[model samples]
Target chain A: MATDSKQFDFGFRNGRLRVAWYALLAVLLLVGGYAMWLRLQGGMRSTNLTSITPWGAWVAFYIYFVGLSAGAFLVSTLANVFGIERLHRVDRDALFAAIVSMVVALLFVWTDLGRMDRMWHPFAWRQVTSALSWEVHAYVAYIFVLMTELYFSMRYDLARVAERGTGLRARLAGLLTLGRRQLTDESREADRTWLKRAGIVGIPLAIFMVHGGTGVLFAVSKARPYWNSGLFPVIFIISAVLSGTALVMLLYVLRTRLFDGERVDRDILDRLATLLAAFVVVDVALTAIEALIAIVSLHPHEVETWRLILFGEMSWSFWWFMVGMGWVFPLVLVSKREWRRTPWLMAVAGLSVVIGIIAVRFNIVVPPQIRPVMEGLPHGSYFPSAVEWATSVGMMAVGLLLYTIGAELLPLTPLDGGDH
Target chain B: MSSNDAMPGVPDTPDRAQLDAMVDAEQADPRAELEDVDFSTELGVAMAEDAKAVSRGEITSEEYWQRYDDLAAEEFGEVYHETPNPAVDHDTAQTIEDDVAESLSCTVGSMASIAESLEEPAGDSEGASEDGEDDDHRWGMVIDLQKCVGCDSCSVACKAENRTPPGVSYNVVMEEEHGEFPNVQRTNVPRPCMQCENPPCVQVCPVSATYKMDNGVVNVDYDRCIGCRYCMIACPYGARYFDFGENYDDEVEGAGEITSPEYGVDRGEREPKKSPVGNVRKCHFCHHRLNRGEEPACVETCVGDARNMGDLDDPDSEVAEMAASTRAMQLKEGEGTDPNVYYLE
Candidate 1:
C-alpha cells in the first residue's frame, strides 16, 4: 500500500473538494429525483413537449450518449482487437467510458418513454418492421458484447489483484475471478482469446447495428424527409467516432492528472488529437453534403426543415457551438502541431469536440422536429425546461459518480507488463 | 328555442284574450290579484267571453273584473296570482314540432339512407373500396368546398362529441385564401383523418398500436400505444396528435370526467395520465358514433352539411357518390396513401 501510494498521487483534492463534489452531486440527485418524480406523476405534461414536438432534449441526449458509447468502444477495439499498440493506454478507459455512456444513454431513453412502465413492451410486443423495435434488440446485443469484452479483458488482472488487495476491491476482484486464484499463462492467454473474440463480434455490432440502428430509427421515418436519406446512418457512424475519440482523450487526462498526478503521455495525446481532428473534418463534410442534398432535393418539408436548422430559432446550436467551437476551434487547436503536443491544448480541443457533438445531436433532433410534418400545420417551438435540464445533469452526475466509484473499487488501470 | 319553451312547470296552453289582458294588467301596475287558482280559470274564461262586450262599451271592463274579483279572492284567500295566460307564439309552437320531426328523421334517415339508399352505387365505380368489408360502417367522408363557408362547425362538433382534451384536435379547418385582394379566392380545406388504404402511421408504430381497419378507418388501440409519438411524425397529413396527458378539466367542468367512446370503446371517465392520456390520438372517423348506426359528431352537427360521411361499402351512399365525383381530390394523393376522405374542388 505504501509503495503504491508513493507510485500514485492520492490527494482526494485535499478532501474538501471531494466533500464538496459529493455534496453538490447529492443535492443535484435530490433535485433531479424530485423532477423525475414529477414527470412520473404528471407524465409528459411536466415537459414542454406537445403533440407537435413529442420528442425533446431527452432524445437528443440519448443519441448523443449512444454516439459517445459507440465511438469509445470502437477506439478500444483499435487497441485490443486491431493491435494499435500506440493507442493501448486508452483501451480500458475507453471501454469503461463506453459502458458508462451506454448506461446514461439508456437512462435517457427510459426517461423519454411516454409510458415508462410499458417500455418493456417494445421487447415483448415488438414489430420487426419498426426500426425502433429493432433498435431495442440491437441495444441488448451490444450491451452483452460490451460486457463480455470488458469482463474477459479485466479477468487476468482481477485475478492478479485478488491475492494482494483488501476491502471491496479484493472482494470484488475475488468474486469476478470466480474464486480462481490461479493466474497461469494459459488462463491469461484464454482471457485474451475471449476478449479478442468479443471485440470482433462487438466491432460490427457497435458500428452497423447499435448506433447505426439508432440512426435508422430516425431515417426510416418517411414523413421526415430531412432524415430519410441513406447518408444519415453513415453520418451517425462518423460523428460517433469523433465523440468516442474526444471522450477517451478527455477521460485519460482527467484520470491521469487529477487522480494519479501523472504527466500525460504527450505522444499519445497528440496522436489521439490528430485522429479527432481528422474525424471532425469528415463529420463536417458529411453534414455539409447532407445540407446540399437537402437543398438540391427541393422537397418542401426537407427544405423547410433545413432552413429551420440552418437559420431558425435553434441555429445557434449549429453555428456557435457545432461550427465555431466544436469543429473550427478544435480543428485549429489540434491541427497545429505545437498545440496538439501540449497536453492542456489537447484537452481543450478534445472537450470542445465532445461539447460540439452535443450541439450536433441537439441540432439533429430539435430543428427537424420544429418544422411541421404537414403544411398549414403549426410549427412546434421548444426549449428545455428546468426539470429536463436538472434530470439531465443528475443522470450525468450519476454516470460520472458510478464511473468514479467503479474506478476506486476496481483496478481500472492496466497492470504493468500487460496481463500475461 | 326560446327560454319559455324550456322553462319547467309553465302552462302548456292559455286563452289568448285573458293572456293579453294579463299582460296589460301586469304592465299597468295593476293591483296584485288574489290567488283564484280555480276561480282564475273561471275569471279567465269570463273575461274571454265578455271581452267583446267590454270592448263594445256594452259593459265596463272594471265592472266585469269586479264581478270576478270576489271569485279570485274566494278561490285563494291571500295568495298572489302571477300566473299569466301565456299567448304561446304560433311560430314557436311550429318550431317545437319541427325540432321533434327533425330529430326523428335523423334516426330514420341514417339506416334507410344506406340500406335502401339514395343512389344506386354504380356497382363498379372503384374496386379499391370493396374488400369484403362489412355492409355497414365502412365510413368515408367528402367535403364540397363550394358549399363550405369555412364555418368550423365540424371542428366544434368534434371537440364537443369527442370531449378531446386541449391540444388534441381531431378535426381542423385549413383555409387557403390566395390571389390579389380584389380577385382573391378563398378555399376551406376541412381536414380529418385520411383513414388511408396504406396509413404510414400504422406502418411506423413500434407496437402496432395504430392500425387500419377492414372498414377503411385507421383506429388507435390506446391500451397498446406507448405514446412514442412516432406515428405523429410519420403521418403526411398531420392528422395525428399526442394526448400529452393534458386536460380541459380546468377549462370545462367535468371535461376530464368523460372520455368519448372512440372507436366504440367506452373508455370511462377521463383521468390524468391514463392509457388514452399518454397515447397518440386522432379522428377515428367518429368510430363510436358509427357503431351506433349514426353519423360522426362532425357529420351530425355540421350546419352547412358541407362535409358528408356515410358507408363507402354501400355504393349508393352520399359520401361514396360524392367521392366518385370528377372534382373530388384528396390530401397528399401523390404519397400513395389513398385517403378515404375526399374533397370537391
Candidate 2:
C-alpha cells in the first residue's frame, strides 16, 4: 500500500464537508423528531400499525441498531482483551461506535414503546416475567460498562492531550481525565487492567443478556408460533456477531477514508469479513432448520406464518433483500480469498452484510404479523407511513452525528504507536 | 332463717316444737324427702313433679316425651292416638308459602318468570312440568353451513350490535369453493371469534386481557392489553384481531359515534385515543345482546334462520341436538381450541 502524503493534511481538513454533513444530519433529526411528535400526538394512528401487523419499521430499526451495537462492542473486545494486534488501530473507534450505536438503539426502542411516557416504569416497576423488562436493565448496565471501557481505553491519549494544554482539545481532554494527568506506567497498567475486566464481563453480557435475550423475547411468545422456538435466541446471537463484525469493518474503512489517514489494516479487515461470513452461514443454516421443523410438524399456524414469509405479498423482501443480498452476496464476496485481501472490496462486503442484516431484522418482525390467526378474519397489510420512514432516517442520522462528534472530540484512532 | 323455715311441706306458721320434730326427721334420713303419707297420691305427685323437672332441664325433652308416650301406651293398651301438633304443621305451611311467593316474584321479573309460574301448579304432574320447562331457554348458537347463502348479513348485524370497528369484525363469512369444475361446491363458513372453551387467545394473553366467561363467551379486557398482539398470532382459528385505531369516518357518516358496548361495557363514541384501539379485540358472543335476553346479532339477522342460538348444555335444546348430529363439526378441531361455535354442514 502506497503512503499517500495528500491524505495526512489533518490541519487543513475541509470545514465545508463537516458543515454539510452536520447540516444534513440536523435537518434529518428535526424532521424525524417532528414525526415522533406527531406519532405521540396521534398515538398509533399516525402509522399503519394495524391489529394484524403491530410491529413496523421502528422495531426493525431497533433490532438492527442493537445488532450493530453488540457487533461493534464484540469486535473492540477482540482487540482489547484477546490482543488481536492488527485490529488495535481501529479498536478505540470500534468502542466509540459501539457506545453510540447502543445509544441509538435505545432511542429507537424509546420511540417504539407504546407508552413512551411510562418508559421509566420498566426501571421502577420491573416485571420479572417480561423479557423486555430484563432487556431494559441489561441495556442500561451495558451502556454504563461501555462508557467506562471507552474512558479507560482513551485515558492515555486524554492525558497526553491535557499535557499539551494548547487548544480546545487540551481543555476538553483535561476535564475528561478528571484532573489526573500523570500518564505514568502504573496509571497505564491500571487503565489496561480495567479495560480488560470490562471487556471480559461485557462479552457474555452482550451475547446472552442484551442480544440473545432480545431473541428470547420473541421466541418465548408461544402465541406467535413462528417465533416460538429454542433456536430463535441462538440465531439472534449468531446474527448479532455477524452484524457487529461487519459494522466495525465498515466503520474502520469509512473513518480512515473520512479522516484521510493511513490505510486501515487489510489483514484484520479480512479476518473480520471471514468472521461475518461464518456467522451468516450459521444464521442461514439455523433458518433452514427452523423452516424444516415448522413445515414437517404441519402445524397450521406455523405453516401459514412460514408461507407468508416465503410466498406472501412481502416475500420479495425475504427472497431478495434478506436471503439473497444480506446472506448470499456477502458470503460470496468475503469467501473469495483474493477479493477479501483488497480493503475496498472488503469494505463493500462489510457494507453488504450491514444492509443484509437490516433486511434480516425486517423479515423477523413483519411476515408472521401479516397472516391472520383465523380463517375468516381479515388479513393485515402494512406499509410504513411517511412519518415512519422519516423517523427511521432521522434515527440513523442521529446515530451518525453522535459517532461523528465523538470521533472528532475524542482520541478514537491510534496515535503514533505500532505496538500499543 | 330459722329451723321452722327449713321444714319441708310444713307451713311457715308451724309451732316451734313441730318444726323441731321435722328438722330432726330431715337430719335422720336424706331419702325421707321422698317419703309421704299416701303411696298412690305420692306416685301421682311424683309423676307431676317429674314432668315439671323435665321442663326445667332435669332430663332431656326426648326422655320427657318418651315417659309420657309410655304412660299413654299403658293407658290405651297400644290404642292411644297422639295427634300431630297443629301449630307446628301451620308454621311449616306458612314457611312454604313465603318461599313460593319470593320465588314467584323473582321469576316473574326475569326470563325464568313465565316458566316458573307455568310450572308452579304443574309440579304434581310430570307431563305439564315438561311443557313448562321449555319456557326458560338457555341461549346458544348453531351455524348451518348448508343454508348460509354467504350474504354477510350476519357479519353486518354483528357489527351493528357489537359496534366493532373496521378491522375488528365480530363475525366474518369465509367462503371456500372446493373441488374442480362439475364437482365444485361452495361453502360459506361464517366465523365469529369462536368463543372457544379452550381458546388459545386466552391461554397466550400474558396479562389475562382476553378470557372466557361463565356464559361460554370469550371477551377482551381492553384496559389491560399492552398491544403486544401475541393473542392474534396464537389463535389457530384466526379469531383474535388487534384494534389498530382505524375508523370508518371516510366511508360512514357517523361510524365512530356509537361504539360497541362489548361485554356490556358502554364505551360511548369510538375515538382514536380510547382503548380497544391499541388492544386485542375479539367476539364476546354479542354479550350486550345476550345480557338483554336476545340472541346474538348474527343469529337474529340470518334471513334463512340458518344460525340457531340456544343452550348446548340442555340436551333437548336445538343447538345441543344439532351439535350432536353427525353433520355438525367445528373448525380446526385438531388444534384443540374446542370452539363453542358449531357449524352444521
Candidate 3:
C-alpha cells in the first residue's frame, strides 16, 4: 500500500491516507456549504438564470446523478437477481454507491428550486399530468427498494460478523441486522429470496420509472423539439447503463489496486470492461440515430438545437467532453481485447465515460433550451455561476464522503468466513 | 417627505423613514376626505351600487353593463358610441342588422358562421373541456397589428400595472425588421400569455399550482407553487417568467411597500423568497382589473388602440367579431393550443 500512488489511494487500509481523504472532503463540504448559504440567502438572484433560460447546471447534474444511481442499481441486479456469481464482489458496493448517488442527485435538484423549502411539495401533492411528480415519487420508491435489497444481501454476513466478535465492527453489524441473530441455513435461503425479489422489482423501476421516466419528463415537453423524440428515453437508459458500468469498474480497480493492495480480480475487470464497451457502442448508435432524425426532419427548432450542440458557444463541451472523451477515447481503449484485459487501462476508460457522461447530461439539458420556443423571444444564454459550481463540487464531495464511510464500515466484500 | 425607514430591525437611515412616510401619505385613501355625495340621476345611483358589486365579484361586469345599456346610451348620445361595450346582448334582430352592417363595412362571411357557431353549446368545442370547466365566460383579447406602431407602451403599461421585478416582463414587444434599406419595414410583435384553452403550463405543473380558471385566465397560486420553473420551459409563448427575487430597491422609492394586486390578492411588501417572489409569473389578462370592470392596462394605455378585450364566448363580443375577421390569426396554430388571444396580421 505504501506506493507512489499512495496519494490517490481511496481504500480505508492506510490510516494517513484515510485522514487525508476525510480532510479533503471536509474542506470541500465547507466550501460547498458556503456556496449553499449564498444560494439560500440570495435566492435565484445568485445564479445567471433568466426567464429565457430558467434551468442551468444544477438541473443537468440532477439528471446526471439520477442516471448514475439507476445505472448502479441495474448493475447490482445483474448479480442479485440474474444470479451472476462472479459479479457479487462489486454488487453490494454498487448498491451502496447507488444510494449515495441518489441522495446527491436529490440535493442538486433541491438547490435548483426557487423555493428550496418547498422541496416536499411534489410529494405532498399529486398531479397525474406531470412527469416530474411521478419522478419524485419514483425516486423515493427506488431508494427504499435499493436499501431493502442491500439489507437482505448483507444480512447473513452481518449476523456472522456479529456472533464472531465483540468489537466496534461486531456492534455495528449487530445493530444493522435489526436483532435478527438466527443465522440458520433456512434464514439464509429466505434472505436470498427476499434479495432476489427486491432486485426484480428494482429492475423495472430503475429502467422504466427512474431513469427512463427522467427521459420521459423531457420527451413529453413538445415545446422542446430536441427532447420530444421516442428515442430519447432509450438513449437515456443506455447511457445510464454505460455510466453505471464505468463507475463500478473504476471504483473496483481503484479500491483493489491502490487502497487494499490486494491482487486485482482480472476476470471481473475484463467482464466489466467488455460490458462497458458494448454499452458504449449501443449508446453511440442511439445518439447517431437521434441526431440523424433531428437533422432530416428539418424542423427549425430541432435543427437549431442540433446546430447549437454541434457548433454553439459551448460546443467545446460536446466535442471534447461528450464525443471525444466519452465516446471516442473509451471506445478506442476498450476496442483492443488486450487493453480491455489491463485493469488500470480499463479503469482509465471507465473514468473517461464517467466524466464524459456529465457533459452528455449537460448537452441534453442546455442546448435544447437555448433556442427560443417562439420566433422572436430572446435566445437563452447560460453558464453556471460561481455559486453553482461550488455547490455542485460540494454535493459531489458529500456523495464521495458517504461512499468512503460506507466502505470502511460495511462488510461489502465477498463473504469469506469472516477473517480479512 | 421625511426620511423614515419603516421596515423594522434594519439599521435606520434617516431618509428611509421619510421616504416611507412620504409613500404612505401619497397612498392615503382619497375617499377618507370626502363626505357622502348624492348622485344627480337615478341611473347614476344604480350604476354606482352595481359598480361596487362588480368590483366585489358578486356580479360580473357584463351584468352591470347590460342593466344600464339603454340609459347610458340615452344619457351620452353620440359620445357613448365612441367606446362600444361588448357585453350588450345582441338579439337576432341586432344580428340581422350587423349582417347588413358587415356587408357595408367589408366582405367576409366567416364572421357570420363564427357567430352562428356560438349559438350551440360549447361541449363540442375542441380543447374546451380539457380544462374541465364549461363556464359561461371565456375572457379573450384581440390585437390589430396594423394599428400597432411598435411604441412599446404595452410593455411599459404591463410592468407598471403588474409591478414586476427586474427580468420579469409579463408583456414584451418583440421587434423585427425585414428587407433591405430602401424597402425596409419594421414589425412589432407584442407578446403576452396566450391563456391557451389547453395551457402547457397548467399541464406540466407538478403541484397543480398553476391552472386554468373558469374565466379563461391561466393563474398561478403563489402559495401552492414550488418554483421549479418547469412551466416556464413548457410555455411555448415564452410568457412565463420566474421571479428571481430581484428588487427595485435601488431605483424606486417605496417599491417594496405594496405588492401588485394580482388576482386581487394584495400581497403586501416585497420580500425575498416570498410566495410570488419565488413563483412563476405571467400575464393573467390583468385579472385584478378585469374583476374591477376595467380593461387590462395595456389595452387602456395603447396609443394606437390596437387591443380589445371581451368575453369570447359571447358571439356578440367585439373580441369574438375581430377574432373571426379574415386577418385574424393565432401564433403557433399548428401547436393545437387554441389560444384565447388573436392578432390581426
What are the DockQ scores of the candidates, in order? Answer: 0.44, 0.16, 0.55
The TM-score measured for candidate 3 stands at 0.82
Model 1 chain A: ten consecutive residues of lowest lDDT: A1-10
Itemize residue pairs with steric clashes in candidate 1: none
Tens-digit per-residue lDDT, B240-304, candidate 1:
88888777766787777767777656679887767788888999877755554567888888778
TM of each candidate vs. truth: 0.81, 0.70, 0.82
Q: Considering only chain A, what is the TM-score of each predicted structure? A: 0.95, 0.93, 0.95
Tens digits of per-residue lDDT, candidate 3, B1-345, equal 324655666555557778899889888353442224332355665677788999999999778777877788887788776654434533222333456767675433344454665543332332443232554679999999999999999999999988999889999988899999999999988898999999988988999999888889998988889899999888888989999988788999878787777865668888877888788999999877766557999999999999999999889778999999999999889878889999999
Off by over 4 Å in 2: A1-13, A30-46, A110-137, A155-194, A221-226, A291-320, A336-338, A379-382, A414-418, B1-151, B194-228, B262-267, B286-345
**Residue ranges of candidate 1 with Cα displaced over 4 Å:** A1-17, A179-181, A417-420, B1-138, B313-317
* Winner on TM-score (2 vs 3): 3
lDDT of 1 by residue, A245-358 (tens): 998998888777765556788878888988998899999999999999999999887888888877887888889998987899998898788788888778788899889999
Model 2 TM-score on a 0 to 1 scale: 0.70
Q: Write the per-residue lDDT of candidate 2 for residues A132-216, one digit (tens) a residue.
A: 6678889999999888888888888788766753566667888998777877989989998999999999998999999988888
